[model samples]
Target: MLLKEIKDIFYKELGDIYPKEEVNSFFYACIEHYLKLERFILAIQPGLTLTKEEEQPLFEALSQLKLEKPLQYILGTAHFMDLELSVNENVLIPRPETEELVQWILADCQEKKQFKLDAERSRSVISTPLNDRSLQILDIGTGSGCIAIALAKHLPNAKVFALDVSEKALKVAQKNAESNKVDVTLLKHDILDPELDPGLDFDIIVSNPPYVRELEKEEIKKNVKDFEPSTALFVSDEDPLLFYKAIMDFSKRHLKENGRLYFEINQYLGKETEALFKAHNFSEIELRKDIFGNDRMLKAIKK
Candidate 1:
């Protein structure tokens, strides 16, 4: 079958449901994944054709797109930072905002390493080199191990641990960790459980926890609201900061002195979320805007 025909079929089927540009993106992504063809294949070879086997998956993907399934889920993969991760209904697709959160942590790590190196060079006695000292980092509610694995991959000296309440989600995270070639200790423990212990203090504790209030469900698109796991995306409207509160308590018990805490937060509740840090023993509270100019990431240091 002609590849262009399939692209036209995708537009005919999904044009109403998604924007024309988005439909084009979906079509191109499907072709790239299923056929290993570049997006410009049509421009270069306008008469390119697909075998029956190649046509099947594209049509199947189109059928799923018509139902508004997320392209990442349909493809069973998502890209976070430099890692391509396995994803499904068991895990929330890693978002660009989350990538920004990871990049923030990485930038801080790099800056600290550089500062330490400079300080050691000026000192007569150097006790320990920053490269030799391993940073202990933990990711709470690690849906697909995206944050934890990315940190471990970048900071090879750091020992990274990931915790998730759902066993299925942990499985996905473990798979992602192994496939990404990063060693992340996966713990299946609910952060909300007050008695549960992760058993290690961390230099950094991070979570992109469920901060979406139940009241905001209406604002979410159908693909997210209907297909993504609700448990991974929502909190009670009455207590929208439930996970943050629990993570704060957990950090108190498990964070090293001056350890940092980071979170990818709900844009609508930036101040409220930052207040959780202020009321506690945290300092240097900073709320950051994502590319969309919405307050979506927060960082604080444990005092």
Candidate 2:
């Protein structure tokens, strides 16, 4: 069948759940990836055809999309910063909001030079830097290793490490590091435990942890609650800030003096998160909104 003919059926299949315009956009984007053709070129060359084998995969992906599987998972790869990462059911799909978090951290690093070392608390807040060798960073609850790999790729001088409690998530993270051709130390670690390795000290620490409450699960869209890893998506209703509090405790012991910490937080808990940090004596706390004007990222300096 011709490309135009296929797209007509595509909209018909996905239009009920997705907007007509969005389905068309996804259709063109998928075709462009598979055929290596631009939208205009694909439009001009209607005669270009897929072989039977290729056609099978295309339709298979289309069918999956109709079922609401994310396109990034269907494609098995996603673009983040300057790197392309392999993605699958084993990990949480990278979202644009997380991409914004990455950008904010990068920009924040640029804004600060040296970090003060807090030996008493074993944490450091980012400040002006003296040299490249001193740069250190850690990513907590790294699902697909997106944040760690991206940081390693972008900041070549920084020593990067990623920690996740789930072994399955760590596997995906390891694969992402390999796929991106960057080295990251992936640790199987639960931040709440007191036995955390004591030697690690980071100038900058970032996390996108499970903050969605169990009570809120009913509110999430069907596609997400059904397919993504649940352990990476949920927190108990009684303790929705569990991860944030635990992470702060972990940072108290593991972070370098004057270390700057960043978190991709639950929008509903922005005020609570800032208060928790302040209660821990963290100063210079700042909350920033994403493009949607929702409180999404928080940063603080250890005092």
Choose the strongest candidate by TM-score. Answer: 1
Give the distance in Å from residue 178's predicted Cα in candidate 2 to where it truly belongs.
Answer: 2.4
Question: Each candidate: what lDDT?
Answer: 0.91, 0.84
Highest lDDT among the candidates is held by which one? 1
TM-score for each of the candidates: 0.96, 0.90
lDDT per residue as tens, model 1, 74-169: 999999989999999999999999999999999998888788788888985754655514789999999989999999999987888999989999
Runs with alpha carbons beyond 4 Å of true place in candidate 2: 114-128
Report the C-alpha lDDT of model 2 over 6-65, residue by residue, as the tens digit.
778898888899988889888887887777667886557878766776567678889999
- Model 1 regions more than 4 Å off: 124-129
Clashes of 1: 0
C-alpha-based local distance difference test score of model 2: 0.84
